[model samples]
Structure formats: C-alpha cells, structure tokens
Target: MAVTTSPVDETAIGELKAEVRGPVLQPDDDGYDEARTVYNAMIDRHPGIIVRPTGAADVIAAVNFAREQDLLVAVKGGGHNVAGLAVCDDGLMIDLGLMSSVRVDPDARTARVGPGARLGDLDHETAPFGLVAPAGVVSITGVAGLSLGGGFGYLCRKHGMTVDNLLSVDLVTADGDLVHASEDDHPELFWGIRGGGGNFGIVTSFEFELHELEEVLAGLIIYPADEAHSVVRSWWEFISEAPDELSVWLNFSHAAPEPFISEEYHGERILSVIPIYSGNVEEGWDVIAPLREVGDPIADTVEPRRFVDWQQAFDESYPAGERYFWKSHNFKSPSVEALDHITDYAVSPPTPDTRVSVTHLGGAVNRVPSDATAYPHRDADFLVNITTRWHDSTQDDECIAWTREYFDVLAPHATGGTYVNFTTEPEGEQSMAYRENYERLVALKNEWDPDNLFKMNQNIKPTS
Candidate 1:
C-alpha cells in the first residue's frame, strides 16, 4: 500500500521556514534525507516538510502552521521509535533532535530534560550528582516515547517505571497552545500522558524525580542454549522472591561474535541473564550467587560498574540502521507450556541476531495502583519481547512471518495486554494495549484532542 502525499507548495514552504528559529526542509533540501531517517532502517517515510524546532516556541509555531494547513503532524524526538511514528508521509514533521538537553537540580533531587534527550543523555547529566532517573535499557532510546509508553529498566524494580518519577510535562496541544501538565494543574491530562502513548499531544520537556544511584553490580551471565528451559524456570523462581534492589532479564539469542564471549560459543544459540543490583554491591554478590551456578556458565561479565556504563553495554547490538521487528506480550506468570514454546523458538530463530527476552516485572513496579496512571498492567509478572533483526530487505517476509507465528503460539498463554512502546503496527489491537482503561482513555482523548489530530501513534479514538 503506497501512501499518496499532497504536492509540496514552494510558497508555503518558504513561509514556514521564516516562522521558526530552526531549519525547514523539503525533499530536495540538503539535510532532508538525514532529518527523515529513524532508528529502524525498515521504516522509510517521506514527509512533505520537516521542521527542526529549537525550543517550545518553534514547536508551537510548527503545530499552529500544521493545523492551519490542515496537514497531519508527526513529532520526532530521538527518532528511536521502532514503529517510526515520528515520520509520516505528506505530514509536517517537527524534529526536536537539536533540543536535546538535561538539567539536574541536586538540592531538589529532580531533572528537567528536553523531549529529544536520549536515555544516555539523561544518565550522563544526572550520574555526576549521584542521581539517576529510571529509564529504558537502551541508551539511544528517546525519553519522550519511552516515558509516554511507561518506561521500565534496570532501576525499575528498585524505584518504579519512569512515569512513576515524572513530575511534570510541557506540551503543545492540538489547539497549538503551550500547556503545562502536572499534579497541581491539568492533573487529568498529566495522568493520561503518563502511559497513554503519544495520543494526547507533543511533549517538549519533562521533569522527573531523580534517585540516589552511584554505582551498581550489573553485567551478563550466559549458558548453553540447551539449558534454556531449566534456566528460565530457575530465573522465574529466583526473581519472584528476589529483593527490590535487584533486577534481572533473561535473553535467548545466538551469541554475538564479540571479544568478551568465547570464540567457540560464538554464533551458537545461548541463554543469558543480565542482573543489576542498585543496593550494596557486596550484598548483591551473595544474592546473585545462586543464579551464577545455573547450567555450566559459558561467559560471565558480572561486576561492579557505573550505572551509566552498564546502560550503554548493549548499544552495539542494536545499531541505528537495521531492519527491526518486535512483538511483545505481558504475562501474569510463565506457564511450563509457554516456557517450552519460548525455548523451541529461541533455539531456532530466523536470523542469528533475533532474540527472545523476558524481563522480570515486579517489586516497586507493582506497588503503583493500576488506575493511578494510564499504564495499567502493574499486575504483570513478566514482559516477553521477541525482537527480529535482519540487514537484508529480501528477508523481510520470512522474518516477519516467524515473529507473527511465534506470537500466535504464545498469545494464548499471555495476558492479552501489551506494552504500547513495543507495538509496531496500529491495528485493532490498539484497545488491547490499554485494556480496561481504553474507554476512559477515549473519553480523555475526546476532551484533549476531539478531532484526533495526533492520530499517528497508538490511536485512542475520540468518541463520535
């Protein structure tokens, strides 16, 4: 299905460029190609005009212009969304890449960050103050998309999801007004944006409560692929009873040909566990000792390292330009039959780089009430994500089919709810992402954006 875009008008493009502080790019402009590129190489979208906003004023102007022109709008923060909602055909794209900045207040224990700031950028700014904001594991992931969809990471068990720490947000609403949302003002809108995806508005900046986190005992432990079934079972049992300070994730994928991994095990399917302890490092060793003894470990990198460093450890695996497809499911518990199905798929991925990951979700994450925010899957025990990656476009059909088939087999065992951030396509499953909160979200959507102007994301349709 090819998208037909309205023809670009030269006079309108010239006027839009003069209205903002940053550059406005057309298809033939110098940086147009670079401006439209996103994290997933599989996404190739061409917008009629791309506006690089310097700050909130620029964003306001862009939004107003788009509304006046009756054009669709796509907001690009870090360009890290796997679904590529940041770029759209024939729409106006507001690029915030130049607005990346992080300001931390040590005394207040808070950080004010630009929407374009990546997780690494936030960590780099706050780590010096012995403070950290709970964010996603990938450093390159944009803060806006992650937080909007309910962020979870190494620190999630200790603190909570990123939205749990969010203090306030500054956004450009459908009416092109710059509004502030916090508990004190516009509280309902604030709650909606916490885990509601980007169906509400364009967030320009975010304020988050930071936690005292200096260093952590974090790294990976790998075992043979044949031990996946037992290893997974052991991990589930251990994590279920583990302390809140410790967070661990299990991955089943072929070993990367990295120097840290043994050459003999390279390219072979393997099961690995990444554990992070935000508490006393010495005590962590004792708590994690049992996990190390699982199935004749092949490689162990667990050690005391800076939290920021550990966040970037997996950066190389997910580079900027790679065809990626991901499917996610939230499970209340991992049944034996489900584990067996996962193990079978893990050992036989369509691509060597394909991976199946199980992230333990409990502790502080579950402490928050389900109705407190729009992200309402607090009762979930684990989040299972299947990431399919391939460099060649020719392999798209087979790789995508394998991911869907894998999901089809596992869906029966899943809770039928999904994480909005991991959703790749905007289909009928949109309501499932929000579950029981879907109707309330729709009501809020009607109040905030009655015309559904921000329909590019996991759309929560306004009532007719």
Candidate 2:
C-alpha cells in the first residue's frame, strides 16, 4: 500500500509544534522561503511543513508525526543534490541543516559526523589531528549524500571509498525507531545503507574511520584544447599501471581565470590533468613528472601543499544559486573509440560552465568484492561526469538537451552502471545504479518501509 499525503491543518500544526523543539514552518511563515531553498538554484519547492530537527529525539518525533499524518517526507542534509530531491512539493521537509556537528577521536582515528555536516566540516575537524576521510571533490557537498552514495576524491586511491571506511550509522527507520547499524549489528541494514542512499532510512549520524595525512603533492597541469585527442589517449594508457598512492583525473572545460592558466586562455576550452599523490613527496614527484610531458602544457602548477587546503581549493567555483544538470557513466575502461568521442565532443561546450571530467578509479576501490557493499561497480575503472551549469533559467531546455545528447553518444562504452548520486532522474534509470543488487534493495524496502513513505530519492520501486 502507498501513503496518502495531505497538507496539515492549523490545529495539526499546534500538535506538531509540541513534537519538535526546533522550528515548524508553513508556506506563509517568515522563514519558509529560505528554508525551502536548496544548493541548486534550479530547484524551487514548497513543502507543507518544514521541520528543523535539533537532535535524534527531534528526528524521531518528526518521523512519528509524519507517519501518523501520512505526510510525504523529504530529507535535506547539505541540500547539494543535482536532482534536488532534498525538497519536494507539498510534503514534510526534515531539514537536518541545524544538526551540523563533528566530533573527532584522535586516539581511535575515527570521527562521528552529523547528517547536516558538509565535506568542509569533516576536513576542518580532522585536519588538526593529521587525519582525513575520503570524500567528493567539492567541499560544500553534503557528507550524508556523498558518503551514502560511495564517496571518492583525492584520497580514494590510497584509502578506500567513504562507505568502505564507514564504521556505523544511527538511523531512524520508518517505524520511528532509532537503530544503530554496523558490520557487527544489523549487518543487512549496514550493507544496505552503504550505497542504498536514503531509501532505507534517515541517517542521523555517520561514524567513519580516518587515515593519516598532512601534505600532498597536488595541482593541475593544463594543456591546450587542440591537443585533447592525443592527451586523452595517452592519459588512458598511463593510469592503468598507476600506483595506489597516486590518483589522477582529467577535466575538459573552459579555463578559469586563474593565475596558473595563461591570460589568453581564460574563458577558452582547455584540458587539465589534476593529480594528488599521498605517498612520500620525493617519490610522488618521480611518478608525476612524466605526466607534464604528455602534451605541450601551457602551465604547470603541481606542488606540495597542505592536504586540507587542497581539498577546499575549488569551493568558490561551484557556489550556490546556479542552474545545474549532471549526467554520468561508469566504465571498465574507455576504449580508443570512446576517447575519440570524448575529445570531439568536449572542445565546444553548450554553456561556458559546462565541464566534462574523467576520473580514474582502481587500486583500493577494485580490491573490494562486488557484492560486499551496496556499491556494485567495484570493477569500474573510470567514471565520466558531465556537468552543464548556467545562470539563466530560460536556457534550461538547451542545457538539459545537450547533456542528454552528449551522454547518449558515449553510452556504448559504459558499464551500464551509474553513480547513484550523479543521476538526475528516477525509474528506468534506477536499475542502472544498483544492477545485480536491485532485488536485495527491493527486499529491504519491503521489510523496512513497506508503504514507501520515503520515496523522494533515486526511488527503489516496491512490488505491491
């Protein structure tokens, strides 16, 4: 059976106000508009009620209220999703934004992170102790969404993905019961939450094991756009034998007006080779030196810097209030044909903000078994993320169409799998995300949330 949702009346609001200590906002409320706004400016939603929970008790109370009232529920952590599932139309919004807290245990090398915390929060807390967690490139992205969807960034090659290091999570199930899941307890639930997204439940807190790191040899090597074809071909062959300590990614986009890039190349299409080496600085230099010779690089800015600063280097580039449409594909390896397609389509972007990134994944990522966690694409060697961003709402159709058309051109080389967080739509596309694990997720959904109360995410359709 499906839930029957409705907008709560005034008397019901008085009752709900007693359930939660935090603010309960309605459409006409003073802060209602700001509460519904999310990271993607393209998303504009109006929830019937917005609940900003202060802690687990408040979360439990809000869930119970929603369950009894049959109000559709939307969970927002950092609110940085491309699909904007964080806010929904005429539902109950559980705004976890107020729960941004981070507690690090220097002795145990672990950190307990609140759902509302961003990647920046995690790094800031752990950096002082010489510890860091593997996460996405963008520091402003929500830790809850990134870790739940299998995070990867500069430390991915040396350490494992964020989910792999996850020790436990405190979740509020549909029953309004707070449960702790880990390898030792509720093992199935633990496995499901690793890459299952928010379909299972609302995660209040995440406990992750940390790795030791202070400085890294990290920077960008820029090449002219005309040399993309040869550069991409050579990059593919080089990363195959790369060590686990060295992680590299390729970006095809218009050059930002930065000091590293030449003045004439600003606003012009260019290819960038970004690398982060976590091993000995001297040894890292030896390994990455050959990359500078791949093509005639217009600039070379690779140098040793504090790892924490490097992680947040691009925070300003992807600010709030920009229309965004992102599409992605997982590949075992991009063939020569795929490389040609990537180069051909990258030179002329639909918008000035459009960016195509090819991230090399292997080493620690491939070492895990396919079904060990809900993240099923362990064998995937590369992930291609195409981002189309612009300021004007009128250009929405043009931007979305370009992203889809470009995605279709590179479909054959893909592994028929996708990163759950990167996809923009639901339904037929959901199957590509979980692959062989789809059946298992369906069973979990039936057992945990039988009525599908939490269907705002990359939905796992129930067989009713």
Pairs with backbone N, CA or C atoms under 3 Å apart (clashes), candidate 2: none
Alpha-carbon TM-score of each model against the true structure: 0.97, 0.98
Model 1 Cα shift for residue 96 (angstroms): 1.0
1-464: candidate 1 lDDT, tens digit per residue: 12226865678777777888999988888999999999999999999999999999899889878877778888898899889999998888889998899999999999999988999999999989999999998899999999999999988888999999999999889888999999998999999999998888999999999999889998889998887888888888888789999998988888888788889999899988989999999999999999888777888999999988888988877788899998898888778888788778987999998888888889999999988999998998889988899999999999999999988888999888888888776535667888878888999999988888888888888876
lDDT of 2 at 339: 84
lDDT for model 2, on a 0 to 1 scale? 0.88
Clashing pairs counted in every model: 0, 0
- Sliding window of 10 residues with minimal summed lDDT for model 2: 1-10
Cα deviation in Å at residue 255, candidate 2? 1.5
Task: List candidate 1 segments past 4 Å from native.
Answer: 1-4
